[model samples]
Target: MIAFTAAEIADITNGRLAAEPGIIPGSVVTDSREATPGSLYVAKPGETADGHDFVAAAFDRGAVLALVEHDVADAAGHNYPAVVVQDSVLAMGALAAETVRRIRAAREADGQPLTVIGITGSAGKTTTKDLLAGILAAEGPTVAPQGSYNGEVGVPLTVFKADAHTRYLVIEMGATGVGHISYLADMVRPDIGVVLCVGTAHAGEFGGVENIALAKGELVEALPATGTAVLNLDDARVAAMAGRTRATVLGCTAQSAGDAQVRAGQVGLTPGGSPEFDLFLPGDPNGHHVSAKLIGAHHITNLLAAAGAAHAAGVPAGRIAESLSAQAAASRWRMERTERADGVTIINDAYNANPESMRAALRTLADLGRGRRTWAVLGAMLELGEDSIREHMAVGTQVVRLNISRLVVVGREARSLYVSAVNEGSWGNECVFAETVEDAYDLLQAELQPGDLVLFKSSNGIGLRHLGDRIALPPQAPGRTATEGSALL
Candidate 1:
């Protein structure tokens, strides 16, 4: 939002200026409730609600400029310059791109440049993104996408955060269908592309895994010749995309994949479920081992992806190792553990889950369970389309294969998992199906005993994190610890 006039905003978005507003400032906003002074509230027509209805409300709440799909009332004492466009959402995107250009110009004017890190993958992108931001912050100022804001609109908004002091910009790119990544790629044009292991995240949306590969590959496909593509060597599909880019390829592998540019060895889980490993980069003198504080073996691969990406961006091996150990989980969501007063430990992966990620989460629970009852409270994996049943069944089977003691499956679709598990050998007695979290919690109260290790996982739509919170902190009572509920056998 480098202070632009109504005329400038109209020109950038290719809209018609309704009136002349002198040097009126522009701060991009989509939500009218979040509108502030001198803000250019973009009234977008969405499936549920249209912002055009709130144009006057935005102006009343300090907004001086409006981007609308159609003419709105400038009546009722509301007098702000308006930009009428055929499509306000598209205009927001175009304006956001223009905003990024202005921000870059301001940074260049001050003789300082911003380095952007573009990350896209099926799983581990968020963790890797959080880790990358922390590592980048270790060196200098950095701004990462807050939460899962990594789409077309989010990408440019993230890029627009760049200023004179902003040094490194970490952008996470997420694709729902084909060509989504390409649009974001066309925006930031990151110097370092971290293509983490591509799995069946949105396989059904883009037809299949092959199309998913091509979609994620869009980020690195047009990278500058000198730019570097950081890929996961352990994932063959992502590894195969290396040569598809003009950028130099840097491969990250958790396993000793015989041939890899950057490999992680001597891997073992720390006492707190963190990973301790040695990172071997290309042409390095010996290797530097990292005792990472993040949870799960899957994180070993994520850490390598981040390190290799940073190395490709010119960070030396020694510095990358330091940055790896220096990294910590930003919150208590991803595999976060909390020991209840009843001695129950809850592992929360409720932020989001897919077939690949859910299996990794269950495996981590098996690896870290302290000879206690390992319980998995899983929810529906959304956006899988036609393959949802098969995928959920795979999750149920994986639970049995891992020898987890108890399974609490939530969500309507998860009933398929329960049915699949019931059909399997040695899994029928271990599985329990619930229609909702409330049902699951009721069953949990009756079935779970003290010392049971519980894991809560689901796509964000189900809000499965509530299960973790209820377990971690039941209503605090005097003489009762943070985890007050007593576990029953």
Candidate 2:
């Protein structure tokens, strides 16, 4: 973070000064294990653990200041050097807002400009952020979220990494309900907002799919009149967002939608399942062709969203295309492709799953496994509210329609998928129900043959990604015998 004394932080956050820390913090950390010299540790509460419990460990590891809900005591019973606030997470947001103000003011004084881009959607937030970051980083010093760090705490942490020299700030915003994105946007005050498709990923928390659209539109609604809003025209809900923001609308479309500012023509996937398309930016008669390193045809929208955001940020269209083609999936487990020496191609897209992404993944699997056997080890999509069972059944039906060779549904929550697949004509050995990841592992270990393609997909909490990691290993590795591997079939 920008240099800040404990007093300054206390004032910025409307917090009270505890024991005077007489120190200037150079960075911010939430996890105590990540604390370093001059770091300000945030004692925020979590679902299972409280951050207040780690304050002392942070101090011992070289933290100079702590932002806490209550003053923490030392061995002498006196309070540790800290800034006490009503809520540490809210204080972090306050600090982040102030940090952005300072950075922008400094840049203005130097005749340079700081560009902040906010990206949000039910899916594709991280992938788009990664793509935008890749293009922006080549232009200047850029700061984007780590992994899926797009929540209240995650956004502030991302802002803390920005300094005076930082030229571009790319934030991924995620919301569970109404006003969540607005709350995040109030902190960073983005110059450009990118709204990818609003899907059913968080339909449960937001009450319904319509509410999700309302929530995701908050990012564009937060943009200034002078700013730009990048909306995916392929999604009707997102296309409707153009009217919701005062900012200029820049539409990104894959299907040659009418008058879209960013268009992808002749879209097709490479043999390896990466999207290849002709990218047409505003005023470009001749579009630049991009053969993306990302693993699915569905990523064409993400590519266009990034291209639109970069163009709004003042990068040339040619440069954006070149950067995008070279940028593979940077974050883990989002169609992350791993080819073992045994000729097994494991597409680990287990980071997170929704109906739209699940279908995209299944289609990509069908394309990639054209002449080879395909296995789909799917877990629950999660948080669909009333639509959960229907959605899982839909995915199972798609798996059968796409002609996926084997179906292994790994959890009780996702048992509907197995039943639906069998009901949809995947009878007998084609579809199997495994009560646990271990059972699925055993089933696959015995059945998977050379040239068999596998896809692991589920919500993050399902832990299917770890199973994918275990199964991706070569059969001859360490403890497993050929006889044991041969029996798994």
Model 1: per-residue Cα lDDT over 1-489, one tens digit each: 466778777888789988655547546677888788877778887789888888878877888778887777677655457899888766766765666566667788888676778999998888899888877787778888877778866776666555557778889999988889888877776878999877887777889888899999998896889888998878889989977999888877787756678888888988878899888888784899899888798898889888887777667889889988977787457888788887888888898889999988998999888688899899989888788999998888888888888888897867888877777754555888888777787687667677888999998888788777776664346665324343321
Model 2, stretches more than 4 Å misplaced? 481-489
Best-matching candidate per TM-score: 2
Q: RMSD to native for every prediction?
A: 3.5, 2.4
For model 2, how does the per-residue alpha-carbon lDDT over 1-489 read when each residue is reduced to its tens digit? Answer: 688888888999999999777678889999999999888999999999999999899999999999999989988898989999999999999999999999999999999999999999988999999999999999999999999999999999999999999999999999999999999999999999999998999788899999999999999999999999999999999999988999999998999759798999888988788899999998787989999999988999899999999999999989999999999889999998988888998999999999999999999999999899999999999999999999999999999999999999999999999989999899989999999877888788888889999999999999888788877777666786645654443
lDDT (Cα, 0-100) at 316 in candidate 1: 80
Cα displacement (Å) at residue 311, model 1: 1.6
- Cα lDDT, model 1, residue 452: 82
What's model 1's TM-score? 0.92
Model 1 stretches astray by more than 4 angstroms? 20-23, 74-79, 109-111, 426-429, 475-489
Which pairs of residues clash in candidate 1, taking residues 3 or more apart in a chain or in different chains?
none
Task: Work out the TM-score per prediction.
Answer: 0.92, 0.97
